[model samples]
Target: MSAIFYIDQLPNRTIDHDGQAYLFFSGTAYLGIPQHPDFHQLMAESMRRYGTVFGSSRNGNVRISVYEEAESMLATRIGAESALTLSSGMMAGQVVINWLQSQHYTFVYAPKAHPALWHAPTVTLPQLAFADWTAQLPGQLSALSPGPVAILVNSLDAVCSDYYDFDWINQLPDNRPITLIVDDSHGLGVLNNGRGIWPTILQKSVDKPASVRIVGTGSLAKGMGLPGGVVFGDANAIQSIRQTAFFGACSPMPPACLDAFLRADALYAEGQERLQRNIKLAEHLLLPTGLFHQASGYPVFFTEHDALYANLLQKNILIYSFAYPTAADRANTRIVISAFHEVADIEWLAESIFG
Candidate 1:
């Protein structure tokens, strides 16, 4: 394995890694604000106003008005009724799973969904028989013992079907009640005109008999270029999860971090114009390689090749080579375009990839 090191050096969009500098075609800094000047200023101001850490959870002595305000903004953005802030998106998932376990509900999930969905103590449907999201969820729901069941879905996987199709998801047998939980960590800031998949699911899940619980988890670190996670859902469901023992036991995001996020939100709004530009650029750059095979919500294009990835890294470009759990398939790599990258950078990446 190659020795991993934190990126302490900033090279041009193309920089030297082993011996050559090449255009970077990988990694998930989608918005590219981590090193932006304005973001740096916001962080500096935040540090002065709100120290390094809050030292308590939302219910503790370190509570800040900004935390609540950020949550409200995020809820409004995602079209949820209320929102809760957490240390990370993984933590948000854990909170949701813990709550579901307390209710003693068996869970059925799309096999490609993030691991956090089934990592808790809940019973999961047989992994081999029901692995695909589009594989008729209603059939699986009918097979479960007569009782409450929760279905978790993720929209990020390349082979998975769209979870936003309301007509199909709501048709589960009327006799059995099921709650739908969606983890949109990858979908939140990059889909549905940037309003996210949460609001669409929330609106569609309203008439279900099982007392619909619509919850979404997102990380501000990805597209938003900030650190933190958000959980939003119906009012009562969020309240129930808050009472869990782990909910209030940890520290909250420092006011400074929240402040930086607030600024990042504004920058994100302005950065949309660049996002569109990069998407067009990527389509042109990657279409010829026959490797940019799929699109989920963002600009992370998937290609099947390990040597392409190692070559890119040798040129100092970082790309994500996340393999699917079912390893029998070909290894896939992801090509991400950051908002911080310029048009020249995109052209250079295209040349490098196709050279």
Candidate 2:
């Protein structure tokens, strides 16, 4: 079987297909805003205010004030000096990488780093676990000639529900300038009380010299429930990226989404609280079974059980199950808990799994 299922409507806590409704425990909607009535209402209202799309280039003569406003709000929320918004998370990374590449810095990538951070056509990643890669980074960086180096990595290993330690970043030698690019698509709006790992990374660099620079990029689609992406860094770095033809040439994110985001602070807080409660409930119910891997405070859980998907489907439940990154890779089956899931929905899922 191809392991594909199609449905007409978006999946939130439940998915309906072929006249059957199934408990949906999949997708990147950790905050569960897809079917959120409040968010929908906000979106509709924002559309009335900003229109569905702002079809002009960011560098055009007439500029929309909301982009700067939203970027400032995002920077304040994430504890960054500045922020830039884009159409998607992937473009956010490419925009950064494009600017960094122009500076002629040597690129060092972590194992299985997202393709958005890839700099060249023929790049090869080290065949090692993230821990092994982190442990060896200092040595590798020290070996390189003292010039410029860009280190790329993710805030968390989303595939296997693992969180990585980046204490090694602060311990690196300061002989060369270092730019750390973190793809926090899975971390922003979900980790560290919704501030994400930006604050933690800032703390790590507090004692370090000015040679080390940090840049955070990610998709707001997951936890934020926005169909856009963002980049966070110092003002100078952000200005350089903004000047690039790439940033100016690409279309901007929907003005309506940014408008809604600016006004959704209370709504986001409510969703985050609900998501935390659901995550705790799921941990209590599912962790003892020893059938999954998870990170503390993260909503996604993973299991290697090939039968779990079909089994859950039989019980009117649907989880994410598929080969990822490539067809040769082993299929990944995960159970994703969201804010939209009620206590009763979780209890039902547990009963089905345990049975």
Candidate 3:
């Protein structure tokens, strides 16, 4: 592999090398708002108002009202009692896991939990259990020795499950005090009646027994086209986690970025109509590809390919490839369909993948 450290030298999404610009189908910027005029203007205005950087932690002089408002909006949108913003999704996961460890809790995880969840030093359950959508979740829950066990679940593909049915997941016997820590990075802004994943989970948490603690983490960089991550739950859980050493040490998000995210949230709400259209297009396109399988929430299509990494690159399509450190090498590639893609882009992608 070649050692490339900078973005400018790396392959640009649009290339003049081919004597014409071609659409790039790589990276997770599905919403295509990174360069949208409204988002751009909001970011530019924020920069002018707040300068480029905040240069302090949320606990210090850098915190802004916009940050608090955004958190509240996010919490309301996601159905959490409160929310905490972090510099990145990895930070969100790390801080949450740190809190979990401080509580002396063990984690039972699905095989597909993101690396951040697995990397946390507090994690105890070694081998992740695997199950498909049809598999009985209650059976799996019952099998676990009922102690201070917390199950780490990803929205989909983690347990080879569908949008986790709240009714089914909450069916954990009242006798068992298992916490459900979910990473809805993919599901947020794209699932749960198009209202986003966090709020749905929060509502479910509210309706469930008080003993069932629900924690959710997500990235704004994906569907929202903004950079940062959020961790949300009960105010006490959030407050407890925020007081940790790790949370205190990290720098807060830049004010301008936060402003941009606030705008992005509004735009995301408006863009839902278009998002639905794109989802339908993606499903139609993928259903014909015998190699592809449909997944609910987030316009993601899964397909198995041994040469996915090299092949997509050869076609100038950037995609996520799960390698050993990031993930166990699976014979599958996840293709994310953004609402920004044109109908032609979808057709072209289908041709490239199936032709």
Candidate 4:
């Protein structure tokens, strides 16, 4: 492990640490909206109009209208019938999970599902690889007799840049109600041209029985660069989530952030375009070296080289290298490409790695 370097300012394409400048490639800011001048201007303008935060609950008599407006826009973008906004993505997942708890559904978790989507002592196939889990899931679900089942999974393994396929959903027996809960914190605004996993899953589940329900939760802070989270589902699911005590009691996302998100369509489009180009370039430059594992159209790149973090630090480049979810977990060392990274920044990163 390398010594921690802290910066006083937000890291975009570069960071300054101890009087040294380094190309920065760490964080969940997939669209690079946090430090973008236009985005900052938008937020500043929104803050003036909407204030920095809305301390009231969603169920309060006085409500800010931007929540509904932004949620509506999110639903349209994600191709869901409805969407709900929360203070953070973790809260969004918890809201849905809390609501589902009362319904008496047996929970089924996919391997590597984010902790936000975890229920108490989740049931999973220990030591089972992702591919094997998917292959054997149908039989396992069938064995869980007559009760309704809720399936929890992360849309993609952010740790390894591996995307999960949902084609197996069609294979599950549909006699009983089935709920698919996906944590898309790493997917929204980064995958599927910025629309995320809903549309793709919708297509794959076309042949599934009507009893299967799909609900998605994710942080807008990642790809969208908003300071909140969201839940996407059909009208009934959103309604049920809204009715939960967790939803009624929790504070909503800042109105300024939501307002900025609503107005940043052009900014998001530009960011996505820039990010795609970066991903292509990074793949072209780095994948052939057989050092990093990358998914098509995803920004994160993963490598297992133990000394790479320290080696890159000496080269004046900073990438994410630490345990996630818990300090007990092994360190995850990877490069995160953002829309703010210029072509030369990536070239420098490549050179630093293998030069």
Candidate 5:
């Protein structure tokens, strides 16, 4: 049944289904902060400070400072020269692709990039085995493809949530003139001790003309429990996006969300610890179910997919089961765990799925 939520979906971490409260295990809020007292206060204070929407053009002389301030936090966290927030992570990707194509960049896609990325002029390379990244992807990228090449890759494959290694990105041959167009929507604030991996990647790759340049985009709506999208890179790339018609026409993020996000550093750190606990719980819960760990913020797919989906719901627990191109098998079934879940919630899901 189609339903409307009485609360923010992911942060609330509980769903009202059939007049019963079901533990919500369906969001990408790896650092679940919505239910936190601090988050509630932050949101309320934000509403008081900035009303609902800024609704002003950032291109104009006058714009919201929170925009830049929030972007600053994002850039600092990811170690980028600058950052921009757009309507969605997809918009951020669109901005990157548009700017790169305008600069004569061709596209090479890593396997299972989000469907949103395929809209660009892209060639899908054969799926390289995980280890092939250091050995294989580099060779492919090194080829003198026509024009500047943009390798669009997911830091974590959306299908099974496998983290693509960026460590070797710094090791690319100096002759390999490539820009890493990375979609980090899944990994930000969810992995690598809540700092994420992009900072390391960007820091490791220097600013030499022949060395690789990294442009990363992601969703704040997921792990950060906020609205809008982020694109961070060198000053030139961020400037290019700011000058675009897309930036001019798009609405800025809600002031309240930005306000809350700016004040959420502590909440995020605490939530990350809680999320780590939940991850461990999920690991233990599913250990005997024959479904191995896929990556952070998600669970594995197995023969128990159908039964577990129903059984978990019957036990007042809810996990998402949907068809995306990236599903573990052809089935597109999976489980998601969040910081909102307690040890009891994990235990309940385990018993329901395994029993």
Candidate 6:
């Protein structure tokens, strides 16, 4: 239980640990980008064309069109006025924190929110569930008026995969100005038909522009299967980060990753449908066993049963158990279903869990 090891190679769906083939269920590449040979060829072409890392300042006289190409596509798809690419999600979180810090805004966070947001001047009501916070948001806004307040949340939680219901934000009392920052790392490629949470949130908040300021930040690593992170928002907010954010001083994101990102729109379209189908297969089979619960359309399961975790492993199925960076309370076995997974693979894992 303590010394099993892993490495990435062929038959990526299964982990070779201590000379045994265990079904691997812990990867985050939801679309299974590596499985597409055409996509792989395109990525290889990009690597050849662009080299690897840029290793310099994007703010310098030199510029790469690939950054703009990917950011433009991302903004259009996410429904943001503009987007700024940073080195990583944690860096993007820092950029947002710095922006909010300069404005001296009060921050409120969801219990399961990313730890990066803890940097802000925050008020934590840990006893309140998400529903309670949403229900009481209007009044909280009223009492905290005469100052800017920000609410930071994981748009779709990584462990549970449940979204911070956009309808609740849309229902907020009118003219109550508040900044809403979303951590969308888990949602970018897998949610809303591969467009992410911002597009859907934008649609919901169409008539309330002055009431809500929507900001999204996340790594391209999770769903986009690319390198770096992004901060997306209205033009002013985006510019603030792009022009002078600390992340800019670091080496630019590897140009090779941007190469993959540029092709994601097309590959994602072909894969999202099958990925969704696989998720449903996971939902259908595992729920009946009483050992797991489906959390939204994503393959992640929230479970408290140690038997479910240990039994699945004994059956040679490998899944992730959350620790550290993932909130301690979210410690659960994650059964990942990728677009590359065969139907037989899905059924086998389900049967293993069912036993």
Best model number under lDDT: 2
TM-score of model 1 (CA atoms): 0.86
Tens digit of per-residue lDDT, candidate 3, span 184-257: 77666667644456666655555576567788887777666667888987898899988888888887667788
- Which regions in candidate 1 have their CA more than 4 angstroms from the true location? 1-6, 9-22, 121-132, 158-167, 202-210, 313-316, 322-331
TM-score of 5: 0.85
lDDT of 2 at 117: 84
Candidate 1: residue 139 Cα off by (Å): 2.5
Window of ten residues with lowest summed lDDT in model 4:
120-129
- Compared with the true structure, model 2 gives a TM-score of 0.97
Residue 99, candidate 3: C-alpha displacement in angstroms: 1.4
Worst 10 residues of 2 by lDDT: 1-10
lDDT of each: 0.68, 0.89, 0.67, 0.88, 0.71, 0.75
TM-score preference between candidates 3 and 6, better one: 6
What are the models' TM-scores? 0.86, 0.97, 0.81, 0.97, 0.85, 0.90
Candidate 3 vs 5: which has more lDDT: 5
lDDT of 6 by residue, 197-310 (tens): 887887777776576788998877766767688889999888876766465686777777777767766788877987999898888887787766566687677666755667
Q: List the residue pairs that clash in candidate 2.
A: none
How far does residue 34 in candidate 6 sit from its true spot (Å)?
A: 4.3
lDDT of 1 at 129: 30
Return the candidate ranking by lDDT, descending.
Answer: 2, 4, 6, 5, 1, 3
Clashing pairs in 3: 26-318, 78-198, 78-199, 79-199
Better structure of 2 and 4 per lDDT: 2
Q: Write the per-residue lDDT of candidate 5 for residues 1-355, one digit (tens) a residue.
A: 2133455343356776556788777767667775677898999999998998777777877888888898888888877789999878777778777777777776777767765455545445456665664577656766756557777777776556565656666666566457877787877887666656676565656543565687888887778877778888888879878998768877777878888988788888888888878777777668667754465444332333455666666677767665555433344446777777788877877887766
